[model samples]
Target: MANTSADDLLRTARELFAVDGYQATSIGHIAEAAGLSKSAVLYHYASKEALLDAVLAPAEAGLAAVLHRFPQASDGNRAEFVEPFVDFLLAHRLEASIFINQGQSLHGIPVIDRANQLVQQLAHAVSSEFGSIADRVRFGVALGGAAYILAAQENWADPDDEPERDDEVRAALVDVVATLLTTTSTGIAATRGD
Candidate 1:
């Protein structure tokens, strides 16, 4: 049998998981898809759970880059977080979809656990930038909205086909994130005594 590296197995598995849903795709399916025997696949990734780590490693790296870039994401540096997140979502739409659509179910898995930690880090990073619990809630909402918009959008398997169109889509997302951060609600207190 032809030899397949771990990277090859991971790339194949990522696409399969995205299309078939993680639960539906098994180790055998991935091995067949990658033209490797089950043992060959197992040799690279000891278990199905480990395969997930390979699939999400790139996206995780992207998030890590954002965290490093803005060690402390601040009001003046909101773009540092928003822009890269948007880029990561766009660049890895399928992977991002699997993350958004079905991540909670994988709670016990280490990938999911680490991802949850990153999310908490992100929330803290944003809240630190914007004062008040209300503002923090807004930040969470903004991030959720941003993720949903991109993840739910069409899966452009090959974005290189239309660079201009992809650019337009990314620009719109960037605008949305910027608008969310800039807009703040001012409370209306009731008149004294009523």
Candidate 2:
């Protein structure tokens, strides 16, 4: 019973945070959505921040794992990293939405800060290999774009109703991101006459 209620609180909090933004959401809102008393929600999470922390913990760990797999800038192909990163975003869409979209507003909170740090690590690892500003921007657009696209899907697509759509989206995102990140710099320089 305790575990089930706690799970409910976490799920409700994540959905609310993703859709409504963390700053706009309140404990009362979470309690009402979870169909529990406000005190019951507090009993499991202690505070709104605590609830956010709980909801974000799995995502934090997942990001850390992704970072661990590719800790530093690589001289090899980026497809290896891009695939897992996209997988991470897909696996944790709600959590990714909350952190990626709401991160700037939610700074100073330790959990958010920790997640932000991991994101920085990832950016550095992936972008450092590209010396040109264009390649780096490509890196940002490809990764950030994929994250944003996945986050935006929550607004309209019900995952339960379109279960296979995720798989299709995942394949296309991986291909597009990898292609964007791997585009030849010479082509860009030629076009720019650099």
Candidate 3:
């Protein structure tokens, strides 16, 4: 049941961090939310930052796993990475929201810095595959749009507990991002000069 307690603390921490803002959230708040004593929260996480780290660790690993497929992307197998990318974003919405909403202000924090690095790496990996600046822009738009959509939802106080909703959103996001990645530049992106 130790795993269950840790999971509860992580979940509570994530929701509180997203809803209350990370700086405003305290270890006590997480403990109270998880229906545990402060010492119990401490048993799982030495500090609020440790709790944040736990919440973000899976997302970091997930993004890294997605990045590992970038070589396949260069070989015209970009489709192989799209679903995993979306799945990572959907699975780590709260962590993404922390970066989206609080990253700049939280600079110098190791986890946030590492998260930013992963995002930059993702951009470089995606952009390096295509020649045109326009393709790079498409990559940026697709990534930015997907991240924004997932992160924005965390602002809602209501928890994301709906599997059907998750499935629908996940499918739509995968389709949209996959289509964007695959489509040839035919719009302003095509015509614009580098």
Pick the lDDT winner.
2
As a TM-score, model 2 comes out at 0.87
Ordered from best to worst TM-score, the candidate numbers read: 2, 3, 1
User: Clash totals for all models, in order?
Assistant: 0, 0, 0
What's each prediction's TM-score?
0.73, 0.87, 0.76
Q: Root-mean-square deviation of each candidate, in angstroms?
A: 4.9, 2.8, 4.1
Per-residue lDDT of model 2, residues 163-188, tens digit only: 44788999999999878876747666
Task: Tell me the spans in candidate 2 whose CA falls farther than 4 Å from its real position.
Answer: 73-75, 131-133, 154-164, 184-187, 191-194
Candidate 1 lDDT over residue span 21-52, tens digit each: 89999999999998889998887788998888
Model 1 stretches with alpha carbons more than 4 Å out: 1-6, 129-141, 148-152, 155-164, 187-194
Off by over 4 Å in 3: 72-75, 129-141, 151-164, 182-194
Give residue 188's lDDT in candidate 2 (0 to 100): 69
Q: How many backbone clashes are present in model 3?
A: 0
- What TM-score does prediction 1 earn? 0.73
